[model samples]
Target: MFIFFGLFADPVSDVLLRISEAWPDLKVVRLEHPISAIAARFGENHYDLSRDKIPTDILLMTERLSSETPSARFLLLRTECFGGICDNRGRILLDGRTLFEAEGDGALRRLIKFWGADIGPEEIFEPLGRSFRWG
Candidate 1:
């Protein structure tokens, strides 16, 4: 995993958000927890743009993660193949895929081109194609 290889930063909030969106049928009581921020812990390097992902490493990781069940497999996709944004509306674009569950729930729109150096929202367009729609 990214942690064992020294890639440290907790995306707990993001993870919870994605989980809620992906499995909207389930209830997610995403309460806050008082943990130290990875930024505060690692500072500059935590958000470092220069940290490029090694192809072989990621492939190996993907292979390892894919060995799990569908639900678990989703985590692999979320971790490696997805880029999400909520737009100005309270909706989630799960890796630029369907987000019918969280309609009008959040209002923060963020454009993230990279989640490290390996993934982006634009990349999602390819796998899902134009067959998908926001509405």
Candidate 2:
């Protein structure tokens, strides 16, 4: 049970959706709020924490995905923009130092791939990929 916590970004949900699609047993949840539209599609778990702070035992959280990628972060934009995953407690699971570094490295590498920098995949993937983990 991973809790998607943050300012309620799209990428977060998008990635969780993908993970859920890949792993059905994985419980992806978010706070239920009026702002949430995915509640209809995914379930009624979508909510605004500020409005209703229902606490639950959370496992993990993913920080908000940035638009730093060349086009858009596949994990953040395409995936999160739809519906996000969250835990019953709402403790965000995506705020590890490694994950932050990985997002930065991945973003930079993605930009370099478009001729913005002269770095190698090893340099980029090492940090970015290092941040992500499977539970």
Candidate 3:
């Protein structure tokens, strides 16, 4: 099972589709409002931080969830840009350990690789006009 904590730079539908294609039997849940989901899944006390704190609190949440549910995997994605500089970050956690972490275009590439997707980075970035920072 995979739980997505936030929106990714790529389209949600496309990302979900790719994941499903890679793991047909895998179940995925996307949570736009993670606080509510966490409360419902693990009780309110499991997440005490406010929405703005999510970015920094993700690891703690993932660790707790992993301890409680051995099969669960957490994917957290977030992007920030300033002064014409953009940073896209992605983290994958399973069994209380981070499986992958990357920034910028590498984040998307790692995600595709993690899912065993046959598609290349060009296939994904092409639609976005390759707007993602590449170095």
| Winning model by lDDT | 3
Kindly indicate the candidate among 1 and 3 with the higher TM-score.
Answer: 3
In model 3, the Cα lDDT at residue 128 comes to 22
State in Å the error of residue 5, model 1. Answer: 11
The TM-score ranking, best first, is 3, 2, 1
**Candidate whose TM-score is highest:** 3
Superposition TM-score, candidate 1 onto the true structure: 0.19
- Cα distance off (Å), candidate 3, residue 47: 14
- How does model 1 fare in lDDT? 0.25
Error of 2 at 45 (Å): 18
lDDT of each: 0.25, 0.28, 0.42
TM-score of 3: 0.45
Candidate 3, 1-135: lDDT as tens digits? 112224221222244454444334433444332111111121234334233234445456555555444544555554344553444566766666777777676565565455444345542422122242211
For all predicted structures, in order, the TM-scores are 0.19, 0.20, 0.45
Candidate 1 residue runs with Cα over 4 Å from true position? 1-51, 75-135
Please list the residue runs of candidate 2 whose C-alpha ends up more than 4 Å from where it truly belongs after superposition.
Answer: 1-13, 26-32, 37-88, 93-135
* Candidate 2 lDDT tens digits, 55-132: 221112222222221222222211121132211212212332112212332343443233223455443222122243
